[model samples]
Target: MKRYAKAVWHGSGKDGSGHLTTQSEALEKNNYSFTSRFTSTAGTNPEELLAAAHAGCFTMKLSFVLDEAGYYPERLETTAYISFENGAITASRLFVAGIVKGISLVDFEACVLEAKVDCPVSMALNIAITTEASLTD
Candidate 1:
């Protein structure tokens, strides 16, 4: 299946504004701007959207990975932080917390590594990806 999103930017890059619209309109022409992207503005930006996508995709991949490894998590909370540097996105950090059982540390680490390589968003990002996970019984 193919999915898509569209970004519409108006005016110059430094003084411009834009909104992103998804095919399904779930985002519904949400606002983005240079100020929002570069500074602390109360608006949505590309980095924020990337963070959301990374977090969601990683969490789903982790869930599947854990299940395949014979561990079922009661809860999984993930955060993806995207860092923008020198006019480019340079890194992403995945922070995860969960309650799981039926797996050892080695197996869990292996599953996480697999997810890091296999998750669609992770694969799409051309940046460094790091992860931290805390699991409990």
Candidate 2:
């Protein structure tokens, strides 16, 4: 199976701006600019989009792990941060918290580690990936 996405950039990187549209169109012609990334702005940016994608992908992978372990988590919350520096993306951190009905900590840790290494997005990213997982009532 193959999946693909496309991005089009126009104008200069510093003073000018561009829009990003994905194959899914979830971000149809969304706006991006240097200020939105380097400074503070009210529009979207590459890091933000990457964070969203990582969080969603990690959560989905965790769900599959939970199902496979017969735990069936009640809730899985994940936050992903992508760090960019020197005009390059450097690292990604994934924080996950969940409430599960019948899973031991040992089992959960094992599953989380497996997902961290095996998740599709994790494989796609070309930077360091770190994860922290916790179980909450």
Candidate 3:
């Protein structure tokens, strides 16, 4: 399956504004601007979108990995931080809290690692990526 989002920008770099539209229109004309990206603003930005994608992908991958390992996950919560600096995206950090049945901490950590490497968004990103995984009841 292939997916794509389109963006259109108007005006100069620092003063320009843009909106992103996805094929399914789930994010319809999501506005973004230099202020939104570089400073706090009332609109969505690319970095936040990346963070969302990374978090969703990693969590989904972790669930699959756990199931394949003969474990059932009761809950999994993931947060992703995307860092942008010097005109480049520098890093992505994933924090995962997991609760599962029939898995040791060591094996749960191994599953988390596998998800970190195998998730599509993680694989697509060229920047440094790290993950912190914890198993909690």
TM-score of every model? 0.90, 0.90, 0.94
Off by over 4 Å in 3: none
Q: Rate the local accuracy (lDDT) of all candidates.
A: 0.87, 0.86, 0.93
Q: Please write out the lDDT profile of model 1 over residues 10-80, one tens digit for every residue.
A: 99998989888999898888888988988898679988999999999999999998887777878888999
Off by over 4 Å in 2: 1-4
Please provide, for model 2 over 21-108, each residue's C-alpha lDDT reduced to its tens digit, 9 standing for 90 to 100.
Answer: 8777877888888888888886688899889988999899989988988888899999998999898999999998989977877778
lDDT of 1 at 96: 82
Model 2, position 77, has a per-residue lDDT of 95
lDDT of candidate 2 at residue 115, scale 0 to 100? 91
Best first by lDDT, ranked: 3, 1, 2
Candidate 2: lDDT of 16? 80
Question: What is the TM-score of candidate 3?
Answer: 0.94
Residue 53 lDDT in candidate 2: 88
